[model samples]
Target: MRIVVAVSLFFLTSTVFAQTKKPASKAVAGPGQQVYEQYCLTCHQADGGGVPNLNPPLKQTDWVQGDKTRLINVVLKGLQEPIEINGETFDNVMPAHDFLSDKEISDVLTFIRSSFGNKAEPVSVEEVKKVRAAK
Candidate 1:
């Protein structure tokens, strides 16, 4: 009877600890994840793996980590025509997200730059603003 009670207590404690140890959902979502989910998730997908031949993936691509101004322009002016990324060609039209605020664009770009197997510098609001101003 004592052994049974001890086992039950151990299992209860283990279960409680396991529940407590689990990471929170919000904690896992970096700054721009919400924006990504709202505007970009549909085409880009939650994993940043874009639609085949239509949308290009954001993972470790030059489009995400390369020239900051160009990346910002892509967001502000939108992307069209055929572009090759990772040896794959994407010819879809990514409509302008110019309506989004500088902060939103900055946060989203920063999030993209950092997430999805991408490790790059975060984009600033000033950078987005500059790119928008250029266009």
Candidate 2:
């Protein structure tokens, strides 16, 4: 009888411990996110908030959410002229990221468009290719 009770208690404790175990977290970064971290995270910041007077913020801005071609050109050809974003003027020179592959550019741009509280369409690889070809 004592052996039976001990076995029952062991099974119950094992069941309770198994039930209390938490599931492992699955935190995976997408391809676009990886590209953004590698290239754009420095100036744009992890949360897309650029430096006050140096780099422009990517949050809810026309530059990020507006015309697709213009945005593509910004990455492909770079921007030398002063630009306004979120009511602030940023004249810093954004060197061309033309070295990045079309897919990488598309992914990074798509990530930016969808992230930082901006709800815009994804930038396709074909779009990046067209822009690069044109430039």
Candidate 3:
């Protein structure tokens, strides 16, 4: 009867819709990995350790481990003054990465915070956006 036909059509439509549904994309390593590869790798290398007296390694560094806000600021505004990494002084002028998109910045920060023996929480796009908006 009509009910049977309607039920059949509903099931058919549901099946078609289910089949057409797109599979979700795999979870990315997130913004941090993407940004690091694009920008930081040139100096820091893939290992998070920089050349001697050059870029300075981020591993167990106070700048990256001591305070989250300070690290975030460094990424947003760039570091110009000399910085001490693992007791070694690095005076290189860290060019301002302020031009990066919020997502990119966030990803880079997250990568830095977590990689190379660092265990900081991932940086959020919203946090990056907030920092950018502040200045």
Task: Please tell me which model should have the higher lDDT, number 1 or number 3.
Answer: 1
Candidate 3 lDDT, 12-129, residue by residue in tens = 9998877666432223455567778888889888898898988989898888767766777887788888877788999997877777888787778777877789987887888777
Best by lDDT: 1
Sort the predicted structures by TM-score, highest score first: 1, 2, 3
Alpha-carbon TM-score of each model against the true structure: 0.80, 0.80, 0.73
Candidate 1 residue lDDT tens string, 1-135: 999999999999999988877766656776688889999999999899998988899999998999999999888889988899999988889999999999999999999999999999999999888888878
Task: Evaluate model 3: give its TM-score.
Answer: 0.73
Which scores greater on lDDT, model 2 or model 3? Answer: 2
Which residue pairs in model 2 clash with each other? Answer: none
* Candidate 3 Cα lDDT to native: 0.79
Among these predictions, the greatest TM-score belongs to 1
How do the residues 1-135 of candidate 2 rate in per-residue lDDT, one tens digit apiece? 999999999999998877666332212367788999999899989999999999999999998998999999998888888888878998998989999998999988888898889899999999999988887
Q: CA lDDT of 18 in candidate 1?
A: 82
Show where candidate 2 strays beyond 4 Å.
1-28
1 or 3, which is superior by TM-score?
A: 1
Taken over the whole model, the C-alpha lDDT of each candidate is 0.90, 0.88, 0.79
Candidate 3 at 70: error in angstroms? 1.8
